[model samples]
Target: MAASAEKLLNLLLRHGSLSRADLAKAMHLSRPAVSGLVDGLIRQGVLRETGCGASNGGKPPIMLEPVAERFGTIGVDIGHETLLRGVLCDASGKQLAVMELPHGNTFESISEQALKLAASLKAAASIPVAGFGVAVAGQVDHAANEIVYCANFPLKNRGLAERLAAGSGLTVRLDNRARAAAQWEYYFGAADNAEDFIFISAERGIGTAIYLDGKLFSGRAGVAGEIRSLLLPSPDGIGLLPVEQAMSEKFLLELSGNCPDTAGLVTAWRRGEPGAVRTVDYLIGGTVYVTGLLTNLLDPALIVLGGRFRDLGPEFARELATRLKVDPPRQLEFRLSKSGRIGAALGAALGVILENCKSNEP
Candidate 1:
């Protein structure tokens, strides 16, 4: 598992299949070096000879592909409310099994629930389970395998990854839910070809995840995407408001006064109810402002809107684009996340799969 071998395998995984000549050209290595690596991989059962590539008036080259069914990983998303969602995925990121467990309030209870669910998923997986990844709704101290702080659940200072690994007997990785969702989208969702983009997770709170140059741009403290702290002008004419206070589901419901849920507010707005319509308009304005600022600063090629925005439907994206005030040249693509609520969970699984693969490299 030399670095060259790992690169060859990764290229095959990304491109589906490749000939030794293609791998040598991509890795700037000689054919003999790539041939050695490929031979080793084939012997290890990690890769297989798929078929033959069309030749340039020479012997047809053998194409190679990763053995997708040889390895799998478990992903768990710890939600803000009371549900812990889990998924089992192969190395190629295909879902094998999915389950949801009722989450407990305390750290011990939640850890136990996730462990149980993960165990079940591992039992159901057809391939060998490499590890587990947990996506939490707040800050994660990945090195320590702990949740630094999370508003949705009382999990501050909890050694979540360590406990889960100990309980389930697997390697574990943890990350912020928004960041994990961004990873999922970049690898398997709408942003597959995008190297730079912004992911806005408008759930119980407003969270942003930045990707730059094909990497997740986690700032010094990994709090780079906490958009909830972004302060903007308030519609009430009282004072400035934080992005979360102005656009979150709870705040929007409060603004509408009579709506008990997002569905109710959507219904009211559809019926031309003044309060609901006004609140929706205000939220849209705030979103436009935030997106405009981000476009000017980052200039990403795409912006993915997820969580509650998905619940708001297609009209929100259309309105946000129409209302955006960025320069014409800076206009960017906006997409609603196709992964929906399970994105974070899938991302967690992807993370573990990647970690295991990387760790296996020499």
Candidate 2:
């Protein structure tokens, strides 16, 4: 897989299908060069001719697309909650299988469950499994394939990737759930054209991932977006509190009269229940403050609200837009995540495909 060929694959993944002329134009390569690369990819079963494109007064050019049955990758999202989610994706980012299982009660138990989920997805994949990617909620040493620390789980310094690789006999990559989601969104979802944005993962706790220029910004400690400790005015008009406590899933649930889950809270909000209204108003205020703070600091172009935030519905974004007061040089827009709850899992799978593509490049 030469770098040019890799770019060809990426271009196809981005555009769905393209002709040799389109590839050549996008890659800035001659048609002969693009044809040679496409020929190689077709022979390798990585790509295939789909159909003929409409002609501009000449013979219709053949369109090419990734062969969904040629390559596969497994991704597992180990969230802070009790459920572990897994997704099997083909080279083109098309999901083959999706699964969920209960997480273990302890660190070792959770690791084992995650491995189990991976194996199950691998069995379900019709194509060759490239590797496994794990998106966890915490600080991860990506190069080391280890979790440095996680507030909800006792997995600090744990060689999670090593254990998974050993158990499944596959390569493994680890990353923060927020960063994983951000990367996937940038390449495939709402932020496809965005070069600078803030991805806010409002899961069990608020986790943020910052993308600057065109790359994720992991600070010196590889936890630059860890804003849980940032102080904000309490919803009760009392003294300040950690952002994590002020705007956490737990707090939201509590505010919604201890609703069983976010879905129920959304239901209550839709019904215009008093408790849910208070909960939403508090969440809006906190979000406005946080977005303004981040805008003043980094001045990103977009803000993506992911995880449980997606359950907040489209109205949430509308309300947020009205309340947010940021005066950056450029206007900042807020959008809900398009990937929903399975975003981290899908992103983790995309990571495996990307890493395997790089490592196996010829």
Candidate 3:
């Protein structure tokens, strides 16, 4: 696969289907070169002819698209304390299947459960599984393919990727759940055209994935977006609290006193209960502060909000917008993630697909 061919594949994936002439024009290559790339991709099972496209005047041109059923990848999102979700997707990042299981207590047990789930999905897949992408709620050593530390879960220093690859017989890529979700957004969601943005995941904890200049910025230690480490001044001037401790779902629930879950808290807030109102205000203020900070630093085009906060809908969006005042030169847009609850899992699968696409390039 030449660089031109890879570019063509990416274009087709983004646009669904395109004619050879379209590919040629997009890549600024000659018609013969585009033809050769298309033929090679078709022969390699990476792409297939998808009927014909409407022509301006002459005969309809043949259109090419990714072979959706020829290659696939699996994604597993390990939660901090609840469920383990998985998704199986094709080369084009279309979901084929999804499953969930309760989180296991130990690393070995969790690994076994995840492997079994992946194996089951693989057994049912029509195409070959390219690899597996695991999204964990923790700091990851991408270079070492290891889970360096997970504050909310018990997976420190675990060769989790190695175990998954060995057990499932497929390549594995492990990453922080927020980073994986950001990748998914960049490649397949509303941020497809965006080169710079912030993906904030506010669930049991607050984590972020930063994209700048069309690349995921992992920083020096792969902990660049770990908001839990942020030590902000307390409102009372008594002490400081980590961002995660101050605004996460778990903390909010604690603040609610009687609310056992997010739903209850939401109800209390709607009812304007004093405790619930105070907690909601605090969370909103914290969120606005972080968004403003990021905006000042990165001047991103978009900010994608994910995790539990996603359910807040328009009210949260409006409040956030009112509070955040960007510089005159920067026009920022904010929206809830369309990836839904399975974003991390879907992102993991898409990461594998993207890596596979790159690997196929010559």
Candidate 4:
């Protein structure tokens, strides 16, 4: 069931639709076997048949879509700044329930708070959470299953996965939220159509998720997108600065005097406020400079924008694209992800879903 379903869905996602014959050839299964699985899924209401295709002088083949409300995965995005947003995503990438964790950023405090959120959401999940993926803003050690460091978070020691897993009785894992978002785009967003691209996430922190040769480029060390490169010098000339130093939630707030970093920017940008425009420009500089520095290295074909600032909308994306055009990559496309906040959690869920979908040895 897992292998056939994965092959079928991957085919659907890739080609938009496929007949049972196409699926059988793609999955190396017999037509009868594929039909049985498709029938089962259709009856379960998780796969819907629609449309018609060429029929070689016979009845046209019916197309199908993975139901948007089948199985759900719990995704946790923990901010270094004491905010946590959890979302339940069904098999088709639709968001179900969102559990926001609003608590102080202490390790113990957030852990306890997260446990409660997980417990409540777990009970709420109509079908068990297919898996749990917890993404964080700071350094995370996937192999060790711990958070090495998250300066913005009030938590002293990291690693919240263990506590959440123990409390909820579910398998859990950690990933850098931005990279997770990039993975989501590569799988389901604007980048889905591009062979290579970079996912730049800007909000409180600046992060990158580069995709090359049609795969999310998570480096050997798992820190490919963390551009801490004090490499980006601020025009003010106050001190050597990292790309994030000149552009983050903290920097934006300092620019405006007060307000939640992302939400406030959304409101300000909507009103055409001067301060918002300036800060937005500052953030664009970091993105522009980073692209300039890395273009020679990765030579991405596109760049997709996501994260909290995604709420700022297409205008922000256009502004960045206008500047980026000044020193464009050798060749690259630009897009803003609709996945936005949902990407991180969806990628986390994909981690678990795809894991269970591996084929048995032939």
Candidate 5:
């Protein structure tokens, strides 16, 4: 990529749009160089003339912005508590359409389910879909694109993405959900401004994915974030199971009414009912204890909270931060992700994008 073009793309992604002179100043590139790159992007349909913008002096320039509707990508995240959230985006990652699929454990149905997900997405797509991405909750062998172990969807360990690709006639890419979600943070969210960060999530299960020196820290077995299996001791004599059992999708639902779904718990939490706050307190407390241990060991620059449970934002961060102070957590920055649920989907798509970029792009 041309150096000036790359800088202009980054600026456009971060700030949404800019007139030619504004982009030139932001990138510190000459006006002619900026204009050349912007013209190329416009001709490729990667950027478009959105309209005029006011100027402090002289006539207003035609405002330019990313043309995100020109292309699209599909992102899938599936685990014990399954979901198929596919985003249609352009080169700049502006979401055009989204289709969501949520289900429970049903692992024995992986092949058929994956095909269904792809087909449904292809059917609903309004534009040419360029790629497909899948993120699973488990340790991954990215070279083989296979899940090594999954607590939620055990059968997902097979060549599931390949099987789906054969069924749909579209090449597929797969990655660990934690790492994929963390990838979103590194490329597009809070971690975008940091060199290294740790991401923890709570969905049907608790998952962790770390980024170090601007890359996914998939040390050894690509199992860096399997903290659900950390096995902390319980306060009572009951010997600890994984903290996921104590503070996860199952626990949240159990903490609220014994609904068959996590939606009930979120609904109650959003309502700010006393029971919901108490439940959040208990779970966040456990999360803080475990995360404090991680901070001492991993020592990431920032700690990001993602996944479904993070919807409980301030309550989640406050409890985690407050308790950490008592034990003196060695100064970890606890923050909610800027991308939220959308980041998970973007992470999945990025797995595919990264693969192609490394091999096919010049």
Candidate 6:
């Protein structure tokens, strides 16, 4: 595959259906060149013609879309604690099947469980599974195909990607779960039209992924999104604490009388419970602080809130706008992600497809 072909494929993956003329204009190439790329991809079984588009006064041009029943990828999101999520996605980033499991006690058991999950997802796929992606919370060595270190996860510096590839006989990828979630938001969720934005995931801790000019920004050493150590005013207005402690799920649960989860905390807040109300207010403050910090530094066009906090619904976004203040001539948008629990898994699979395009793989 040529570079132009990869770009065309990615464009279609993002925008869905487009005609050859639209592709030519977007790619800044001649119609012949775009046609050639389209034809080649169609022959390769990744792209397909999807009927015709409306035209002004001439014959309608043929529209193209990704083949949703052919090439596919499997993804596994290893959560910080007991939860693990897996999904089988087509080339167009649509989830065809999903599976969930509890994390195993040890590294070997977890690895085996992940492999089995991947195998099960592959078996459930109607299309050919081209690759497997594993998304974790902490550092990842993509070049080495290993998990460098995840504070809350059991595995450390394990050749998880290689082990999965060898076990499943497919290409493998490893990445940060926050970044993977960001990818899902950018392509299929609220940030579809955004070129610069911040995706904040409030899970066990605070994690973020930055997109500048439509590209994911991984800072030097691939730790750009790790803000867990950033110190801020504590929720109780008692001195300062790191984000991991100040805005963590554990803190929220504890503050809400150890509610089973965020959903229950919301229920308590709805009932006008003082503890739950305080907890929600504290989280809102923390989110506003973090959003302000990032917005001032980067001046992004949008901010997306994900993870357990998404259950807070539109009221969270509305409250964030009320508390967060920005200067004149610069407007910021906030949106809550609707990707659900399978979002990271879907994004991990989409990562495999995007990487495949970049690598010129079939």
Q: Please count the clashing residue pairs in each candidate, in the order shown.
A: 0, 1, 0, 2, 0, 0
Work out candidate 6's RMSD over C-alphas: 1.7
| Least well predicted 10-residue stretch by lDDT in candidate 3 | 353-362
- Give the winner by TM-score: 1 or 3: 3
Q: State how far residue 312 of model 1 sits from its true place (Å).
A: 2.3
- RMSD for all candidates, in order, please: 2.6, 2.2, 2.4, 4.0, 4.4, 1.7
Predicted structure 5: lDDT:
0.70
* Segments of candidate 6 deviating more than 4 angstroms: 359-362
Write the residue-wise lDDT of candidate 6 on 140-256 in tens digits.
887887788788777687777877888999988998888998998888887979999999877755679999999999998888867888888876578899888877778788888
What TM-score does each of the candidates earn? 0.89, 0.91, 0.91, 0.81, 0.76, 0.95
Model 5 agreement with the true structure over 124-144: per-residue lDDT tens digits: 777777778888777677788
Report the number of the highest-TM-score candidate: 6
Candidate that beats the other on TM-score, 3 or 5, i.e. the better one: 3
User: On lDDT, who's better, 5 or 6?
Assistant: 6
User: How much lDDT does candidate 6 score?
Assistant: 0.84
Candidate 4 lowest-lDDT run of ten: 353-362
Clashing pairs in 3: none
Candidate 2 colliding pairs: 1-362
Preferred candidate (TM-score higher): 1 or 6: 6
Where in model 1 is the C-alpha error above 4 Å? 21-31, 52-61, 263-273
lDDT (tens digit, per residue) of candidate 4 on 197-226: 888776556678887776767787777867
lDDT of all the models against the reference?
A: 0.83, 0.84, 0.82, 0.71, 0.70, 0.84
